[model samples]
Target: MNELERSVLAKIDQEQLARLCRQLIQAPSENPGGNEESTVLLLQSLLQDLGSTVHLQYAAPGRPNLIAHLGGGNAGGGLLFLGHSDVVPAGSGWDADPFTARREGNRLIGRGATDMKGGLSAVIAAMASVNQHAPHIPLTLICTVDEEANALGIEHYISTAEAAQYLACIVAEPTDLITIIGCRAAANLQVQISGASAHAGRPSDGASAIEAAAELVALIGENKQKLAAAPHPVLGPATWNVGTLKAGHGTSIVPDEAWLGIDRRLLPGEDPQQVLDALLAAARNRIEAAENLDALKLQIRGSVQMFMPGFLTDPEAPLVRQVCTTLQDLGAAGKHGIWTASCEGGFIAEHHNVPTVVLGPGEINTQAHQPNESVSVSDLHTAACAYALIALRQYETSQN
Candidate 1:
């Protein structure tokens, strides 16, 4: 509510913000599709137009990430804004074309609109305003690819020495404008079990991978019970999910292979690899102890398909306070919360030791990944102002 904050807020262009949101939603950077290049290009041009120095780094061929720095940051560090370009597949059950962003009254409808594209657009628009009004504030915006499927883009980013200098990070995930100070981590493991094939008529003739897989599933259920006993105070307890199971070709033939998809949600201090190791070890022991099963002949191997670590920032942190204060000033209720879903914040927090906050413009539970995903147009405007004001105030406080 000072001169710079008021000026930056006034400078935000509402129509342009909505247009950019629609454009990004139309881009279709699906993670399973492995297409984030187009989204990166869109963001690169926008950031460049806003007077940011943009760098395009590919985590994989055709998978590009953008690192844009603006507002003349401080000597060694500055505020960082995190946005992921990739989105989950726009599955069936939409009222219209999922990729076609349709503005219906207050809601802008499309895939990625709620999950992140809306929030991402707000950040860019805020940076545009801030760049015009207050170019002296230091800010870095890193948009990564593949946050939905795997986190290779963020992994690649942290490996670079440039990540170590950030003072704080704001992940533009859907939070309905709530300021999230912590979130649980997510890791995906694909377990494949192999056994000798045989006819179902003779059960003892061949090892049944399906039967063994069932036993492991039951044991993992027990593991879930153990996890329920102890939960984190803020982010809640670690959890396990047996998301998928594929086995047996037909009713008459003994299946030769079994595939299992497991999802583990880790706490702030948990390690993804170590959790997988223990789960696999328990599966092996269960198979070994099972009666009439050939444990040595049966092979069970699993690997981490996607691993995202969790993060918890102190509620008293300046970045958290700034976001909350901004939210309150913008006529939105300011509160600290935790995200059950995973995002790129954990990677920045864990690897770079940056305090991370998740604040954005939409609803995660109701809108994100849902058909006809949408975000409030009003929420987008407020988010733009909030992001800009937070950056300006944070840098001012740091200087003081």
Candidate 2:
């Protein structure tokens, strides 16, 4: 490590880092209502204190995003650190208060602590550390809202011209300190089945929409098996989930309407539209082939409510290499991997063509979206160092 890198690493204050993580977790920026204004203001103040220029942009009335820039004067390209501020709802089964930010030994426990608040705090601390050394490398930090819900904050940011100028992006998602080069795409599918309604006593007079919906659901399950046959080398197979099913109002009446909600995960090369079309066609064919259902006059409609394309960044890319090398220099094993869950990295990579990687602290399987979410304090410290070192190295490379 060079003098600047050493200085930046030394500037990381563990207490301050812990305090920031606690404060953010306590803010309760849950996505259902998307109350991120408080979190945005907190980040704005933190960035300002680090001597960085902070901009607050709103995608909606109560939903805001924070963009902080430092040291862009002499650099031709800058590194962007992207993180989300919103967290999934903290459900029951917590041993302690989900928002209390309890610390036991090396672990800090709370909602959003591992999912991303801890990562976000690490990024903020790293930015502050790098700012102290007065390095010439340009850096941008983006803390977006609604990542747990619709990801509107990032969706809005990437639509602007500023998002296209980044040399690379590091999304601080929970990755257990490994480098994630790709992630699967995701889409929400809604299937509506329509049929005639009648009294429960007259079975032959009315068609049961519930029965037709069940048949369609069975067809979807069969299609899922076909999708699993072809899997991406890194991302694994495309998957489908029937998340929700609703039909019929009462036990006495034959239901006229039914709905099925599905979550479809697409592989890197698969087209989302094609997948939807194929599923619809399968349902249509199955319904037409059914001998008894012809008299029921059943109809099925499929629509995609949301779509996020999958992406893969070459492991040999300059930014990816720098990140891996920096992690190794920081005394951590650097390995390239893929994330099964969806993240903003996919959107950034597909829409802006920016090479993006997911690298941060905490284990996603054990900590993310769980009742008592927590992150290792040691992991947080290492993440701070890694982020700082990567920024410094990227700056040096740009200068050469």
Q: What global local distance difference test value does model 1 have?
A: 0.87
Q: How close to the true structure is residue 118 of candidate 1, measured as C-alpha lDDT?
A: 96
Off by over 4 Å in 2: 73-77, 161-163, 294-296
What are the per-residue Cα lDDT tens digits for candidate 2 across 248-267? 98999988889988899987
Q: What is the Å distance of residue 14 in model 1 from its true position?
A: 2.6
TM-score for all predictions? 0.96, 0.95
lDDT of each: 0.87, 0.83
lDDT at position 129, candidate 1 = 88
Q: What would you estimate as the lDDT of candidate 2?
A: 0.83
lDDT of candidate 1 over 1-400, digit per residue (tens): 8787788898887778899999999998987998989888989988887778888988999998888888775333577899999999998999999999999998999999987999999999988888787777778888998888878898888887464666678898899999999878888989999988888899777888998899889988888888888988878888889999999989888888999999999886678788878877988899999997888778898999988877888999888888898899999999988888888888888777888999999999999989989999999999999998888877777788
